[model samples]
Target: MKLKCVAIDDEPLALELVAKFISQTAFLELVSTFENAIEALSFLNQEEVHLVFLDIQMPDLSGMELARILDGKQGKFKPRIIFTTAYNHFAIEGYKVEALDYLLKPFSYEEFFKSATKAFQFFEEKENHLSANIASPSEYIFLKVEYQLIKILLKDIQVIEAYKDYVKVHLQGKTSPILSLTSLKNMEEMLPNDRFMRVHRSFIIGLDHIDAVVRNTVHIGDTVITVSENYKESFMDFLNKWIA
Candidate 1:
């Protein structure tokens, strides 16, 4: 699949060069080019761009500021960002917002291709993972943590806790939970409905692992999860099946 991309830079020459490089790449499609970050932001809000080649030192709205805006945006339209700047100091700040890659100024086509390739591989792997899950409901799932994809068995999951932009996957035999950069709502969609249930806004518990239920609370080993009012009725329905 061709990644729909856009290049944003204050320098006209830099923008043209990046656009030319994008044209040379087989997997990337240049959707549009922006001379400023503000116009790019406006375009991004109405477009379905998958990748962005951004310059860090643009006037008025710097690429760093624009990256922050995109990073903070909710939903699934978050396009991967690759910062292109002459200064090396912004690398840390660029990564702080989780940019896919960073491109230093006056970079060769080879360098641009390398960064583009990383973005391609990421999206490709992500699509394949999702496709595998949907094609066959499996006993295990792959969670991407940082640069690696960790395999986790569905049966081993005791609880899933939402922690800001990440989810804590509490396993059966593990002391520390595996933290992944994902939302609990996304986790709910990935997990099997028959084996897992969302007990609270911040939690999803394994049905088979529940030790006991007391009033609005559910005990799963040492973890006591409170069943929120929204999900209390559903949790009760599941409990009623085993009620004598």
Candidate 2:
């Protein structure tokens, strides 16, 4: 099924690029484009959209504000948001808003497609409830280790560390970590968001395995991973929900 989408950007070129990219993707259909956030929000109230291509900086209402407004609305349809911004500073803010992904300015079609594909996977999993239940204790993931496909239980994961093009999967009660040829971003997308979170650019720690949060550091076993400024807000948001 084609995902109904909309593009909102003050910049003409950016809006044009998003619209063009949506048109090229077989699974996405560009329903409309809005230069202002108010008009976009008005449209959202009247219609159901599956995905949004939003530019962060705008004249009247910023993309961040629009996302927060949508989040506040109690509804059955909240469009998956992909933020587009020239400044890399807003990345953490995007995460705090639970944005599907963020596209840095001057992004190529390849980058756009990668983020779009992540959105597709998310919606597909949501539509199929069984696949989306990664939080189940019986859930196991097959990872390529050496020449073998090793099945690892989701509940046994302690931490996942990214090393260049590869990732080291550390497990609880296990001395040896599984090494696989995969990007941390790709792995993060597969894991349940409520269970695993990216504290740093290189680290994705299991929430259950975390021993403590001292300032900006997350203590999982003896490893002290610093939660970078970019992700601290979202990580703290997660902590806030369970603190009481």
Which tens-of-lDDT digit does each residue in 1-244 have in candidate 1? 9999999999999999999999999999999999989999999999899999999988999999999999988886789899999999997677667788899988999999999998998888778877887898778988877644688999999999999778999999999999887789889998989899999999999998999888899999999999999998888888888684
Q: After aligning candidate 1 to the native by TM-score, how far in Å is the CA of 13 from where it should be?
A: 4.0
Top candidate on lDDT is 1
Clashing pairs in 1: none
**CA RMSD, predictions in order:** 3.8, 10.9
Clashes of each: 0, 0
Candidate 2 residue-wise lDDT, 112-131, digit = tens: 99988888877775565444
Whole-model lDDT values for every prediction:
0.91, 0.86
TM-score of each: 0.73, 0.57
Which candidate gets the maximum TM-score versus the true structure? 1
